[model samples]
Target: MPALASDVTVITITRRRPEILLRRCVPATGRQTRPVDHLIVVDDCPGTAERLSAAEGVVWHHASRTPDDMSGPGRSSRLRNWAARQVSTPWIAYLDDDNEWQPRHIETLIEAATAAGADAVHSERNVFHADGRPWLEPIWPWSADDAEGRSLYREMVRLGVAEPGRNVIHDRVDPLDIADGIRMVDTNEWLLRRDVLLELPFTETLTDVHEQGLLGEDDLLLADLVNAGVRISSSRTASVDYYLGGYSNNRLRHQDPDFAWR
Candidate 1:
């Protein structure tokens, strides 16, 4: 049986991508097997909320500043944190504007977390290129199968991180397990408890000097969670589909100068 819809809240953060929001994200979220109590959309684009349809039981909020207007880093983090404050459920799940979730995404995460008594649960994510081509080949520096990735996962296990295969639950995750070379997990693929999440909110400040090559907000948040000793569970099942569009975080084409854009 799926978890109660009243126990979970889904939040989607978007900025000026109404077409993607309406066409892709909305349908996926709406089709979830275990419906959420509240579906909140944090629109970072000013005046875009007025254009969103209200017939889908979606509660919309407009951010004071658009992503382009923000001077420093953490625009996405700030928007997500703001939207999180509006949630009243015990569990919260995030979905990106361009990405999508399988019908059992929430159901799987909630079930796993509940069964393991964990504060957070994460599932695998399948990546796809803009033209609907599979992008499963892990990109360097971020691929979890690399040498650094093996070390990070080993450290996680050494520090009492529960193995999803065994369905075991650990009381707390060790902070020291989070090394500098650790592979970061995507926020869209995880479900977190509301209280624990609020205690270790996403960092809204950018310490990195590079402007164009700014690191991901999800990476920072995951580091914070690890440092805070939050217990996290993982499922190998790919329940989320991440689209690599021009506006994606990795910016595939931009990162690879020689890559062709079709």
Candidate 2:
């Protein structure tokens, strides 16, 4: 295999929404303070790589077949691994088809990593509905007092952040916990150790598994991470906008109180 390229890699696994992924999401990432080495666009759509080539920082990859569960089933993990394996960066960031980071998102993650002395650091997010509705304000707590911050139990009770779908940053640890059953982290916002992720792939069995009708791949991944004794620190400084597309019609048991945070 060729030596992995130098620089941070921002990997995106996309299907159908080429316009949004390439035009909006990719460009926004292009503006990051830490210039991305490559934007790996894993084309989940048939023959979408050619069109995806139009984006500036994109390096397109294709899977042999389409995934059974679009929500999670090995899609993000497979894409991240495939893209990450090519780049020799110490850090790898994941973004989904519909999500976009703020320009400062990467910078913020880098800053938080430097400050906390953490092996992995994850940021919070703002969510939006497809019809331009303000679905949520930033929901995670942001106080130095751990007492004031929402614990995993509180988030689970309210159903805020469980999926491996949020942003995260991680450094090199021998094996990554991508397969545990209970998830307390979101992978979309995660920065991971490129080498570790390359070794332990996401659990296809856990991907898109239904828990009261909600997908639980991300949650399971976190449970695995914590079990591995990896140090994870979370703060609100790094954040992203989770665009709720029309296709994602899964309803939350509660929405109003879930959006309200102290």
Candidate 3:
């Protein structure tokens, strides 16, 4: 019954990391605690569908060229917004190129949001370095009840949650109105309602920056959502393990902020 309660669709935006897609992201969904309606992997790279499809229970959305045949944050963000449109489920969960989800991640988010009477839900991310080192746990911890963690000013001032200046995190709160009644969250660690997400599209302008351009599109998106009256809920149960890699000699595969996502 729990499995049939909601249809969860995972939108994994990827480029030329087929091996990681098959080895990590693919298997992670198979181990999900709830039923996954579909797994859509948007292959922004050319001629990579066969490789991405090697994994079972996977559907591929291969795009020959990005919005401008470009490579960078915009490419991934464009693909993510596209894939979100293809899903028929009521819920959508996003996973990055290098990150993978835990077995109970989706199910936990579903249960938490449903129980908390929230329109959207997000949780902590367990950060892991490329050398397999643990940097921190529960990257951002917030209260369970909306009333407790609802103030945009309070959160921005103390928690340093929405660093709008950095553009890494955006608060949905309106600059003029403090009490918009919407909820905000960490995009990497959340599951969103399908209908609600369709209304909030990622910015294409931010995607066109240089390789190392700093922008908190994700943070800004969440802040805007919360400020718009979307109820945000946080939980410890729903989480993902993010791989943090060091800059190596290999320029082709060096994991830096240039390749790191928003």
**How do the predictions measure up, each by TM-score?**
0.73, 0.68, 0.70
What does candidate 1's lDDT look like per residue over 165-244, in tens digits?
33222322234645533344677887999898788887777653433444566767777777677888766567888776
Query: Please, what are the lDDT tens digits per residue for candidate 2 over residues 1-262?
Result: 2233645677777766677776667777777887775565555565567676664546667665533434344445555556766777888878776777888888787777778776566777665665445543233222222443345324533443323333322211223544322233456677766665665545545312343334444555565666666666655643676665422233442353321111
User: Which of the predicted structures, 2 or 3, would earn the higher lDDT when compared with the native?
Assistant: 3
lDDT of each: 0.64, 0.56, 0.60
TM-score of structure candidate 1: 0.73
In angstroms, the error of model 2 at 84 is 2.9
Give the residue spans of candidate 3 off by over 4 A: 1-6, 136-185, 207-213, 245-262
Highest lDDT scorer: 1
Backbone N/Cα/C clashes per model: 0, 20, 19
Which candidate's TM-score is highest? 1
Global Cα RMSD, each model: 7.7, 9.3, 8.8
What is the C-alpha lDDT profile of model 3 across 92-192, one tens digit per residue? 88776676778888878888899888777877655455555664332322333345434633555454443322212332323345554333444557788
| Ranked candidates (lDDT, high to low) | 1, 3, 2
Off by over 4 Å in 1: 1-5, 42-47, 66-73, 136-182, 209-214, 246-262
